[model samples]
Target: MATLARRALWPAVAAAASLIAAVLVAPAPAHAHGVALVPGSRTYLCYVDGLQANGQIIPSNPACAAAVAQGGQQPLYDWFGVLRPDAAGRTTGYIPDGEICGGGTTKYAAYNAARADWPTTHLTAGSTIQLHYSNWAAHPGTFHMYITKDGYDPTKPLAWSDLQSFWSVTDPPQSGGPGGFNYYYWDTTLPAGKTGRHILYIQWVRSDSQENFFSCSDVVFDGGHGEVTGVGGSQPSGSPSASRSASASPSVSPSASRSASASASPSSPAGGGSGCTATWALQPSQWAGHFQVNVTVKNNGSSTLNGWTVRWTYTGGQGFEGAPWNGTLTGQPPNVAVTNVDWNKVLGPNASTSFGFNATGTAPASAPALTCTSP
Candidate 1:
């Protein structure tokens, strides 16, 4: 984990600024809003890994600090916002191979460096897993997920030829979750017999805008189930904190919301003046008469720490199937509820988090409008 400080967004989005002597016609960015993939994106995990009890960030992980040195601290400050505003669904050929991680941005080029020692999530080979994406800004979009081909080496620069997408979904199912996290959720089946470590890449291309968000999540197919062991969590070295630094940047604080309600009005964060917001995606399950859901919530509030609650109604008369993990759930059919578990309930201004669940429905019908509330 690289140490980092909490960043406050310049609300109302960002104005194009000239920096690094790079002359571009597009406006400079201010608030980065898009996603934080779970188990976690590189920027998101590194941000968490670098945090200290005192809310300071000086990267402790060797890779994270190296990334900062290469890319500068600004990209880490805007974790959710790595994008190509001009990419019109072009992949492989469109983005330069080495620059994929940064979306070809000079500021985030360090992340494109070929190296090991980055944080990783552990999983079983060929397991079907749920995926979550945060909503810093909500827009209708399609998601594309890919994995590196077998025998591909992480030590080498990433190329488009080295990856093959396994999943491409358009507006998957999602729930309006709490804790400042409105997420988009979908299930993916890992390729069979995949062993060792691999890179899980994600691309979120918005239909409303040309901008597209990307992510690189590290995973090891070690039959460990869904346990994520790296960065702020555990470690492949069996240690939480690897190398430590005396001086750290300001820590990025995560906030959470307590409970949400089924309401007509959307839950927009109180980002002083700007309307920080949250959004949801809900799709029908491929399984027999089931529904999968995701909610992507944003935290652009004045407060640092927060909690949340999520509520909804099954207009299709469907009900939940079982208990969900990482949070608590209640109610049935028409009126449903879920609250943030003790662990995940925090968001930083312009930051986001995510959660998910499933229900009994052949196909997802129009659910009642949702409302997320905060602490």
Candidate 2:
């Protein structure tokens, strides 16, 4: 009887141990809470995708709420929508979407469009328009607005000259607490008798105090006539004369800037050694001496970089002297300097940093080769 009892006791102990192991190994339920615009919700019918549970789109469900309450997850809040007006007689709606995580960090998303059912009668030539904007998110930030006259291309951006005007929130930037909201009004006059379709582009930036940044949204506008009414106040006078002369200006190019920022991470060569990569901005020949050359370095390898060296050859320029602590160029043009970037030296896998130097001499029309070494 004693031997039989011992055998039964051992079997029961083994079963209990297995159950505990299973409980420990099982994954917690997928936490999917974030600010999502319900399709067909009230006056808006848009979808907010790719929202982060703790970072951007806080989970509002009971399970997520419970988890957050238990200090296991981050809480999220929704952003309210508002209107923004620019120098040109155009209005746009700014909506705060939730947050998303990319490249191991959280980024905010904002919805941009024209106000729903804005009276067209108020839109006249030379009419100074005031945009009544608002913010209803937990995080505080300001919205920037841009207007494109020839309409916008999702794949191809319009030329800089085609942009009618732009506006941004003023100093002492806007902010909001939990369930807090703000309203702002911007004033701009419409161009005289310039009747046609126009596209409005709006972007938001989180304040330095906040950790979130705004993601761009698609543009929308209502192209009606100057006969509608019953929205805001009357239009202003003295519309500026419209000009149609096509002139190419030396403004900054969006494609070039985006390419510089986006090309920070390049795929490693099939058989290359372990290290990071860096790229320099394209400088035009005429403006070479007075220009600043910005370079972005990204770690493509799996290892962490404690220190790195960026080497490049210039035909008309001098060699690098040294760089600032954060890789900023602080010396005169034509001389090479090493930017001492201690903060940037410790780059993790797939991380990137940007630094630049002023160039005195003209840049060669063609781009020079750049090499990076890890220490």
Candidate 3:
């Protein structure tokens, strides 16, 4: 009996060792096939929104920030990892309703939130567009593109029943690689009559492995070519230019109440003066549903600036949390006016200073362009 038990234990140990070896030799788990880029998917575009020049992920889009606030930064960093290793090309009952965006996995669950404020790609209905699917970890696969059925409401959780197969491509021509401009490219005509907001659900069903990847690209059929909203500004229409990086540029025009951009010229000052410009930045915060705003006042004139004032309106229902620092705050929500205190009022030519305040609310999709004035 003891000999029999020893033999059984040896087999178990051998199997365990084999499994460990397989795990050790597998590709990095965080890296995966990739997500939609042309009409950027939620995770892909949010990753683009939050990525700073310093390699930090700080989302400026309210929807992106809310997703980050719920799931932290891993989902965005692993933006391409929204997959189910055991799915085996399964749909419907496999990935539950309401969690389709995240592939029914907790790692990317935040993206499953039902909201209309997500960064959006604009396209015309029935137009032929090139689909650029990333090849982060290239493998033989068939790409299935699905669109939400007509009259679909984006404010509700997504259900598989809402999607209808639109297009698919098998092993399309490949270009770029493991990083920038890398993707499996193909062109297909979009389904006709899709208007307003809808989710484009994509599945990369690998022919070689059971591993499958999913992406949710929020799009609108509003006659616009390929401009995006809620991510600082509109992305250039058409395929992403070679000069564009994985993270799209955030310096373009602002998206109404969702974000703000500096005007071409100094905004008309309260007293018709125009010697200063103000730019606002959202600072890192530890709490969810809250943000810190930092506004910098720069003097562009040749003479000394004896005093400065900055004013802006908030349209997203954000309210101040506490008294501001280094400045005096006045007015109320939807309308904010700030002026420098005694210690930091004066500035020489080309000099700058900043003031900050905390706010209680989800980050707005856009910030109001700030206008600075001097008396």
Best by TM-score: 1
lDDT of 2 by residue, 1-375 (tens): 012112334578876665455333322212221121100011011111111211222222232233234332221222222212221221221221111111011211112212222111213344444332333333345555555554434223333344554556543232222222122334444455444334333444445442322222222222211111111111111111211010000001100111122222222222212576766664221121333344666778888877666655556764322222124343333433344343345677976654444344554455456666676
> Residue 159 deviation, candidate 2, in Å?
40
lDDT accuracy of residue 164 in candidate 1:
87
TM-score, every prediction: 0.57, 0.27, 0.57
Q: What is the lDDT of residue 146 in candidate 1?
A: 88
**Ten contiguous residues with the weakest lDDT in model 3:** 248-257
- Model with the higher TM-score, candidate 1 or 2: 1
TM-score of 3: 0.57
What is the lDDT, from 0 to 100, of the residue 170 in candidate 1?
92
TM-score-based ranking: 1, 3, 2
Instruction: Find the candidate with the highest lDDT and give its number.
Output: 3
lDDT of 3 at 152: 88
C-alpha RMSD by candidate, in order: 15.9, 24.1, 18.1
- Give lDDT tens digits, candidate 3, residues 101-172: 999999899999888878777667998766667777788889999999999898899999999998889989
lDDT (0-100) at residue 361 of candidate 1?
Answer: 64
- Worst lDDT run of 10 residues, candidate 1, spans 244-253
User: Lowest summed-lDDT stretch of 10 residues in model 2?
Assistant: 246-255
